[model samples]
Target: MVCVPIALIVVVVLIDVLAPPHIHLGPLLVAAPAITASFAGPRLTGLVAALAVAAQALIAVLRDRDELFSANHQAQIAALVLVGASLVVFCVVRERHARELSQVRYVSETAQRVVLRPLPHRIGPLRVASLYLAAEAEAQIGGDLYAVARTGHGTRLIVGDVRGKGMTAVGDAALLLGAFRGAAHRQADLVELVTYLDGSVCWDLAEPGETDRSGETFITATVLDIPDDDDRVDMIDCGHPPPILVRGGRARVINAYQAAPPLGLGDLARPRYHVDSFGFEAGDLLLLYTDGITEARDSAGAFYPLAERIDGWTEDDPAAFLHRLRRDLLDHVGGHMGDDAAMIAIGRAPASRP
Candidate 1:
């Protein structure tokens, strides 16, 4: 690739020198540095630009020794040099921006790993897989979050979406995840764990300056506790989208009978957190996701029908199922999403005997 630009310079110089005197191809030399800027750093681009300028100067001398100092030739040389200089400047600016963007991406990925750690492929008796899609083009993680924790009796999980996007939403997500990880093990009951999370969110959002947003800011989440030896999973829904259960090639939403308010608004709603128990058999697969998945719109403004799409998908492998769903969802949204989406697939494996 680098040689192509250098060869271009050589070809242009030779052709301009060998062509008729009336024909001037010196202007084409500017393309050499322009091409170099696309794939090379500032130093290399500058070198290519200098070589192009030198080649232009050579063309002037070879084309006409007497007219070397003439206005026409001087202008041509000056134009080539100016264009090359401009291209070099452009390369410098581009490289600096590229470096800054790389740094930002590194920091974003590190922060995401800390705040939204990936779930293990296997947790106790369940095979789990998770996916997260950030709405922002340059962001790796946003308002959508999921985390899993192992307790003495069962495996606990939480999937939540913050009220908004951007840094504020990220902070809120981190807060909720931290709270869940810290208290999921200590709290004996699913309701107790959710209560602790709600209190944490309420306290954080109620801080002095945050009073204005305290009422409006809330996290919609669903917390689950799947006992290692039981076929039923206990759940507490906090105004989040219901999970989907796929059994015998049929998919259905596991709606919460008694839903509670979102985390931050628990005080206003004064809601009672109800623990809903659902059968999660060995061959059953449960999917928890954020609203972004259900709310995604295609070009025709039609929402993606997730339940219908996955109704007959009997892929028992949690990872493969989520991979197919991710591709389908992206295709449905025309390859761009307006909001962050997250999904977690938990499949109970066949029990093992001692």
Candidate 2:
């Protein structure tokens, strides 16, 4: 960038020195300051402007040594100086704005880390990898959330999506994650774990001044329990997308026969959360994701066909499968999604003996 301004100054000088006298190449010197405004700050721009002024004076002297300060050259010198000063001011403003933007991005990333802690690679007998893509790039974390914990009975995990966006949604996601982490160790079963989370979220929004949002706020989550020695995975779906089971080079969605209403609206219909069981054999992989993955759309308004894509990837390693899925999803949506997305891939370790 600095080179651009310097080069412009050099070319303008050459033209002024070598070109025909009637061509009047002095005006072109302003290009130095103008180009510097794009990439350099006030100090650098001012330096370029000074050089331009000096070059103009030199040209004036070269043209008529006795008339260097005469009226004819004075007007041109004043114009060049005015334009350079204006460009210096513009550079100052641009640099200030850039610094402010950088600071804002730093704060946003810090908040994201606080809300969404990193997922571990190994949990109990399963090898795990997770991914999150926020719809709003400025907001590193949105409504999507996932967490895993090793409990006394087994390894418990939850993948959830809050109802809204912005800080409110982030707060709700944090609340649910915190509740799950605390309750997973104490609750003996999946049902109890989910019940604790539901009650906590329900009560959180019902607080004195928070009731205004209570009517609309809710979270859709899927809770899972993988026992240490069992060959099955248990799930409790609360108005969320179903998990997918991959085994023996085939893929299938594990839909729940019964699902309760999403938490925070349990007062509307107090149905019991059913625990759905599925066979998780050796070398099997389980995929849990939020709606952002399935609901992603292309220009033609077609939804992402996740199951069809996964069918061919059933035999791929868990890490490779997720990598392909993420790339394919981005391509399906033309590289921009309108909602926050998250996915967790859990592969049962084959070496473990029951």
Candidate 3:
């Protein structure tokens, strides 16, 4: 539908070029974007149309003083009409888009509430915090995802990255979330949960149909379980970045004690998972994230430093810490994200005095 008007603009331009002695192309030209004004987003379409009309109007006004029958008067009328029509279209389309955007946001927010429920402010004497950036500004869902649930075993957490974006990625993500929520509760160990997720992915792969495109959907994930607040934090690195542990105001990456392949396509070979244990002490911060954070690059292609970036910024608030991280990440990436990002922070408060 939006392409139709763009085509109309091209035709109008061609017609004017071919037969400029007759046929008015200016109004049609102005109306072309005005047609897309209802779809290209109100702000963008309106701005573009305004600039286009104003530029031509000024050109016509300037040239009229020196020319005979310069088509200036008629152009001015058409420009003004288009501008006015664009404004009206902008208002109506803006309202419609606002409503649609609101609905998408609501759905996304609901999905977040259901699938990415925030960890409690305090989880077993530790402060729980997190941040999430969906790849699409208009869509609530993306390929990166994370979830934390206090299971019978302990605080179970899962962070995974799906392939691609848009509707297809969202569908895959939904499958993963359902698997995690079910298996997280049913399975006692994180490794078994990994197996369940692998099976689920393989199942979903078949649904997308066999494509000889030499492409398959796979997810890089990390699963963690905290047995207690002061004990070691158990983590399974299934291809995610090694989480960072901050203690005494120092941040350090916790390398996987053992490495394993990413989830999905595991039937190609037997998958092995190494559970790494990290020292969890009072006043220590544990940050887990998807690849989006580490992969965020500046205009110069300098990748973001996941572990070393926020060493000295000390705020006792977990949410604030993650929020600041998100802002810094966007600033580094020029306010755009090429991939979905998800993160969760678990910090142990200073131990109660003995």
lDDT of 2 at 352: 42
Per-model TM-score, in order, reads 0.86, 0.81, 0.69
Candidate 3: segments with Cα more than 4 A from true spot: 1-113, 136-140, 207-215, 350-354
lDDT (0-100) at residue 179 of candidate 1? Answer: 94
In model 3, what is the error at residue 156, expressed in angstroms?
1.5
Which stretch of 10 consecutive residues in model 1 shows the poorest summed lDDT? 134-143
Q: Candidate 2 on 186-214: residue-level lDDT in tens?
A: 88778878888889988898888774766
Give every collision pair in model 3.
none
Local distance difference test scores for all models: 0.89, 0.84, 0.72
What tens-digit string does per-residue lDDT give for candidate 3 at 326-352? 888998989987666888888776767
Misplaced by over 4 Å in model 2 are 56-86, 134-136, 269-271, 292-305, 314-316, 326-340, 351-354
A best-first ranking of the candidates according to their lDDT comes to 1, 2, 3
- RMSD to the hidden true structure, all candidates: 2.9, 3.6, 9.1
In candidate 2, position 226 carries an lDDT of: 92
lDDT of 3 at 240: 73
Q: Candidate 1 has which clashing residue pairs, if any? A: none
Q: For model 3, what is the error of residue 33's alpha carbon versus the real structure, in angstroms, after optimal superposition?
A: 14
List, residue by residue over 1-354, the lDDT tens digit for candidate 1: 889889999999899889987788888888888898889887898898899888878887887888788998788778877887888788889888878978877777677667788789999899999988866556545778899999999899999999876678889999999999999999989888888899999899778876478688889999999999989999999999999999988999999999999898978888889999989999999999999999999999999999999999989999999999999999999999877789999999999987
